[model samples]
Target: MTQHETPERGARLGRACGADGSGTAVGGAVVLLPGRPGMPLLSPGPVRALVRELARAGGPDGLATHVVQHADGCPERAVDEVVRRYGDVPVCLAGYGSGGLTALRGGGHPAVNSVLALAPCLPDEKASAPPEPVKHLAGRQVLIVHGTNDGRADPESSFRLAARAKKANRSTCRFEVHSDGHRLREHRSEVVALAVDFVLGSVMGGRWSRPVTDALAAPPPLGLRMPLASGFGRSLRG
Candidate 1:
C-alpha cells in the first residue's frame, strides 16, 4: 500500500492510502472517509481493515481501495477528490460518524454508484420541517447502518433521514445495529462485512445477497427498519 499527500490550491490535503499501492481497477475503487478532521479513521481501524479485506476479496482483477482522511473536517471534498481520481470508474462512498453524513451528502456525485453510511451524524430537523434534500440520490443505491442506542448522534435522526432518502431513491436501505453505540465497535466485524458486501455488489459487478436485495426492494419502513441480527455475520459467510 502506498500513501501520499499533495498540497491543493483550495482544498485541504487529503492523505490517501491505496490497496495495491498502484494503478486503476476494473472492479472499481472505494473511497473511505473519516468523521472528523485529523482522526485516524483511515488508519488501522475497522474501515482500514475493510479496505484490505475488500482488496483481497475482489478477485485477481483486483479492486482499488483508498482511505481519504478528512484533513479539513470536510469529507465531501475527500469524496470529490476520489471521484476525480477514478474518473469513469464507479465509486462507492463509505464513511463513519460525521463522515457518514458526508457520504450521504455526496451521494449525488455523478460517479458515485453507492453509499454506505455507518452511524452518520445527521442534523436533528423538526418533524414539521421539510425532509433533507435527497433527490440527488435518485439513481444511486444507498445503505445506512446506524446503531439503535447511538448516543453521540441520535439514531432516530438517521432513521428519519433514511426514510426521506428511501422516498427519493427506491434502492435506499437502512440497517439497525441493535443496542450498539455511535462507534458501533460492539459488532465491528459484522458491520464491516456488511459494508463490504454492499460495496462489492453496488460498485462492482459482484453478486448481491438475497438479504440486500430484499431490503432494497422492500417497501418503505420495512427495508429501512431491517435489523442487523446476531446471525447476520454468519449469513454473509454462508
Candidate 2:
C-alpha cells in the first residue's frame, strides 16, 4: 500500500492505494470513502473486510483498492478529487452513512460505473437536500443496503432513491435487512459479502449470476416472526 497526501484547493487530501498482489496494473479501481470526520481510509472494519473479500474473489489481477480520507466535511469535493486523480480508470464507489450518500451523489460521474451504498444517510426535508439530483443517477448500476430498523438514517430514504432510479430506468437494487439498526454491526459479514459481490460483478465485469442475485434478494435470518402480543395473541390462544 502506497500512501500520499496532496493539497487540493487548500484542503489536505489523503489517499492510500493497495495494489493487487501480482504487482501488475489493474484496469479498474474500487474507491472507498469514509463517513463524516472520516477515519483513516480503509481503517474501518467493514471497509477492510470488503477489501479482503475483493482480493479473495478477484485474486492477484483483480481491481486495485483505493481509499480516500477527507480532510473537510465536503464529501462531494473529496469524491471529485478522487475522480480527478484517477482519471479514466473505471471506478466503483462504496461508503457507509454520510459517506455512502456521497458515493451515491458521486455515482453520476462518468468515471464511476457502479455504486454500493451501505446504510446511506439520505437527505431530509428539514436538513440539506441531496447533493445531486436523482436524474444524475441514470445509467448506473446502484446497490443500496439499509437496515429497516435504522433510526439514525431512515431506510425508507433508500427505498425512495431506488424508486427514483427505477423510474429513470437505471439498474438498481435495494436490500432491506429487517430488524437491523443504524450501525448494522450484527450483519457486517453478510453486508460486506453482498457489497463485494455487487462491486465486482456490476463494476468489474464479473458474473452477476443468478445465485448471487438470489442471495441478495433473500432477507437475513436475523428478523424474527412473532405472534401478536395483544388481542391477536389472546384470540389465537382462545
Candidate 3:
C-alpha cells in the first residue's frame, strides 16, 4: 500500500496474467464496485477470483478497492477514495448491479481509462438521473457485459447504455451478452475470459469491436417497463 493510502477491507493489488505467464505492468488498475443490497466485496466468490486473475495476468502494484454504503453515499466520495490511493494510474471501474449505478455516478476522474460493468442496475429515469448520460462513459472506453438471463436487470438496460455510449462517439465501447444470469456464477469461466480479453485489449490498444450485437437485439422481458416507479412519475410531473 502507498503511504497515506487507506485500504478498504480486503483491498489489495498486484499483477494480472496472460497465458504462459508473460505479462507487463501497463500501470493498469481495476476496482470492483459491489451491487445493491450492497454486499461486501467478498460476498461473491468471483470478485476474489478476478483479483487473482489480475495477479496472474500482471496487474500494477497496490490497486485500491472501495465499498460504498449501498447507493446512498455521494459518488464523489467513491472517486475521491480511489484517487487518493492510486494517483494517475490507468484505472478501470467495475461493478455488479447497483454497484455499477454508483460507479457510473462518479465522474471527473481523469485517470480512469475505462469501465467494466456486469449485470449493472440503472435507476429508472425516476429516483435520479446519472450525473452524465450513460453514453458519456464511452467518451473514454467502456465494456458492458451482462448475462441474457438476468431477471433483476434486463439486458436491454445495458443495450441502452451501449447505444448511449455510441451516441457519445465512443468507438471502443463494447457490450457482450452471455447466456447466464445476474450473478454469472453459472457461466463463471466464460464471463471471466471475456472480461480478461476486454481489459487486456482496452489497455493494449488492440483492435476493438462490439462483442455481441445479435444478442443485444434480443427482446426484453415482457411488460418489464410498465411498472414505473411512482417517484419517477412524480419527478416528471414536477
Local distance difference test, each candidate: 0.73, 0.62, 0.51
- In model 3, the runs with Cα more than 4 Å from the true position are 1-26, 60-75, 125-132, 172-174, 203-238
Number of residue pairs clashing in candidate 3, backbone atoms closer than 3 angstroms, sequence gap of 3 or more or interchain? 13
- For model 3 the local lDDT of residue 100 reads 70
How would you encode candidate 2's per-residue C-alpha lDDT over 1-238 as one tens digit per residue?
A: 2222232332433533454323544556677776666366565437777777766664354466656664443345544554554445567777887778878877777767788888888877454554336676777777778888899998877776766665663366677766677776667766676677677787567766443455334433211111111121122111
Clashing pairs in 2: none
Candidate 3 lDDT by residue in tens digits, 1-238 = 2233333322233222321112222344555666665477645635656655545544433333333344463355445545554444566666667767656655235656777776777655444655336545545566566667778886777666666555554433434444567777765665565565555555444433233222222233211111111122122111
lDDT of 1 by residue, 1-238 (tens): 2122322323432433343324434446677776666677554336766766676666334456666665544456655655454446677877888778878877787777898888888877877877667888889889999889888988888888888888878999998999888877888788878888888798777877777889999998899988886656466663
Name the candidate that leads on lDDT: 1
TM-score of 3: 0.65
Candidate 2 achieves a global lDDT of 0.62
Better of 1 and 3 by TM-score: 1
